[model samples]
Target: MDRVKGKTAIVTGGATGLGFAIARRLEQEGAKVIITDVDVTRGKEAAGEIGGLFKQQDVASENQWISLIEQVRGEFGKLDILVNNAGISGPVQNADPESTSTDDWERIHKVNGLGVFLGCKHAIDLMRQSGGGSIINMSSIAALVATPFITAYGSSKAGVAQFTRSVALYCAQSGSKIRCNSVHPGQIRTEMHDSLLDETAELMGASRDDVENDFKSRIPMGYFGEPVEIANMVLFLASDEARYITGGKFIVDGGMELGG
Candidate 1:
């Protein structure tokens, strides 16, 4: 208990799925958490249940990001953890570069790419003032591999990975106590996965069961990871125990990315 006692955290898109899991785990470990999501209903409920605060936020907007940080300072006095987890997988249409419309690319990049950049850039100021904090960016295995069907998604996540490394280096060079890292989760069982599976099935003209099995078979563990499993990694990074770790890419993929 109290693994992150007295810490203050802001988890963008914390209303559901992996974001909710991260928020809940942070709360359980004694962080005073503020969960933000565009989904007001669910975000408020989740925050209330965990004894935290909820705010409607659109991470894609620079204006919203500015206001959120200011509000966090006014309410919490100091920010300790910033989890940039808000993102979209982009439309799964024909997703190859040619089939991917400019609209799809722009929309996904705004949230998944630029939003993360804004988060890291702004949060670093507050974290430095707090005498250093952790920045956990939600990257994905998609960033490390090619998935033409998820062209926009993979590209945005790649930006995240590189951004994470750049932030970590900046902190280290400046002799700051701040640490930055990225978490790459693969095939986690969540609404997002369900949607991805459904889309893949439709795209491939395969049964949903067949699509799911194909995904599972790609994992050495042959199963989808639970939300909490990914959350635990965030918890560790948020804790002081990971003081020595930074600029790291922690892949939680059940060896799916491993070569045979």
Candidate 2:
């Protein structure tokens, strides 16, 4: 149960869905977790529920990232794990490449792409001071496949995957024990997923159930994934059990990326 005992972790967007599950899992396994989110109320509630701490943060802000890392350093004396899980899918109307506005594209990339980059960058600095640690960036199946409907999100996530590899190799070359990897989840049953379904249904003029069923049919597993499933993977990566693993892209996508 103490897989990450005495470790210190920071999970972004931990107020809900996948982030909350990941934070809870890490804390349950004995890590001292700090949950961060733009949603201050829910963030505090979530932290309270998990017996962790809460910090309000807008991940896209470099200043916030700097402050967060410093706070972690001050409170915990060291940071061991970081889950860059905060992101946005963008408005469904302008998500397509052809219709997406420059501002829309930049907004998605700001949070999904730049946020992870900053997290890895600052976390590396802190982690190096205290030996080394693990950095888990949450990507998505959209990153690995064609996502014409969510061009910005897919592109940003793709950037995350490639960047993770670069961070891992860079750390390894620099003789830093820090490990970096990306986790790509497919059709997880989260609020984000629900929003996607609702939007898709509206776009297609179909019932939500119909849209959901259609999506389910494409997944080889024939169902959406659970948050705990992804959390378990993060736990393993966060633990010393995966000490040898670095620069890897772990896909937890119920075989949906294998093609329908």
lDDT of each: 0.92, 0.94
Off by over 4 Å in 1: none
lDDT of 1 at 153: 91
lDDT of 1 at 28: 93
Tell me the TM-score of each prediction against the true structure.
0.98, 0.99
> Per-residue lDDT for 58-80 in model 1, tens only?
99888999999999988877889
- The Cα error of candidate 2 at residue 238, in Å, is 0.5
* Per-residue lDDT over 67-175 for candidate 2, one digit per residue giving the tens place of the 0 to 100 score: 9999999999999999999999998876787999999999999999999988998889899998999999999999998977789999999999999999999998998
The global Cα lDDT (0 to 1) of model 2 is: 0.94
Between which residue pairs do clashes occur in model 2? none
lDDT of 1: 0.92
Number of clashes in model 1?
0
lDDT of 2 at 49: 97
